[model samples]
Target: MTTFDRREEGFENKFAHDEEMKFKAEARRNKLLGLWVAEKLGSSGEAASDYAKTVVATDVDGGEAGVIRKVIADLAAKDVAITEAQIRVRMDELMPQAIAQVNAGT
Candidate 1:
């Protein structure tokens, strides 16, 4: 007689994947926010990295959407050329692979 092993994926695994996707979306948003802020601040190199961190860190206390809104608002307040339209366009271009990476946990 031959025996095979079988297993059932649990609800937790499904939920975990959902959370992972959410996180990945957030990371991509953070990256875009960083670039936006860097451009707005006329910062490059370490300063840009620092600004990105500051913006992303805000999400650590609040959440991903909050950080995104802050970055957009801050740039707008400073009269940067970045518009909500551009942000949405960039996000549309970036989201698919980001979602894949998130699902893969990379």
Candidate 2:
């Protein structure tokens, strides 16, 4: 392949990977926020967990990232010590299951 073609292929690959990474990262952030809110609300056991799931789904559907971050930051400001990265990881872990449960409930 010509050098230009090879460079173009590499750029395309990088772009695709970056997009995928962004999607995964956003999912994780949402899930992490859900978990934090569930804990903050003191939800526990099966019944309480169902309630928490509902809350998380609601927040996610609203599509208000600023609100979510504000809440997270507020909690941290009060000493929760949560960073954005931590939120992302937690959210990624829980968002998929949360989405599934929500879809089933609907």
Candidate 3:
């Protein structure tokens, strides 16, 4: 292959890898967020883990927004009294930790 063609292929591979990492990071963040919310709702151990999994699954349907919506509704239903902004802030805070964890293969 020409040098230009090889360079293009390298760029494509990097893009694919970056996209995969981003997906992993987001999913991790969602799981962390779900666990935090679940704890607020008085869940623990297996119940919290299951709630986190549900949040990760919700991402398939609506990404972050959907997860946020689901958690907001859940919190409200349980009288937890949290705001969207607070959840969003928590999500932002978890993202870097999620990215680090994903990079570490944990």
Candidate 4:
């Protein structure tokens, strides 16, 4: 293979890996957010964890909007009284931590 071909392949591989990491990070952030909300909703231990996993399992059509929209509606239904701004803020706050956690996994 030519050097140019090798470089192209390497770039593709790096892009794929970066995308995977982004997905993992987003999922982790969703899980963390879910746990926070679950605790506020009075769930704990296994129940809280399960709830968080469900949050993480939500399908993302484009970006975090799917997760955030679901969470906002769920919270409203439970009368938890949170705002979209708050959720977005929390998500922004947790992204780096989630990324680090996901990247550091065994």
Worst 10 residues of 2 by lDDT: 23-32
Query: Can you write out model 1's per-residue Cα lDDT over 1-106, one digit (the tens) per residue?
Result: 2232222345567789788778767776676567657877688888888887887678788775676687788787777767667766766776776676666766
Reference-based lDDT, each prediction: 0.71, 0.59, 0.97, 0.87
Question: Which candidate number maximizes lDDT?
Answer: 3
Better of 1 and 2 by TM-score: 1
Put down candidate 2 lDDT per residue, 1-106, tens digits, no spaces: 9999999999999999877665554444454555565566555566445544554465557554653565575566556666677666666666676555544542
Task: Kindly list the per-residue Cα lDDT of model 3 for residues 26-58, writing each as its tens digit.
Answer: 999999998999999999999999999999999
lDDT of 3: 0.97
Q: Per-residue error at 6 for model 4, in Å?
A: 0.5
- Tens digits of per-residue lDDT for model 4, 2-105: 99999999999999999999888888898899999888788999999998887887745535777788888889889999999999999899989999999899
What's the TM-score of every candidate structure? 0.62, 0.47, 0.99, 0.91
Q: Model 4, which residues run further than 4 Å from truth?
A: 60-63
lDDT value, candidate 1, whole model: 0.71
| Candidate 1 error regions (>4 Å) | 1-11, 100-106
Q: What is the lDDT of residue 80 in candidate 4?
A: 95
- What stretches of model 2 exceed 4 Å from their correct place? 45-106
Which candidate wins on TM-score? 3
TM-score (C-alpha, index-matched) for candidate 2: 0.47
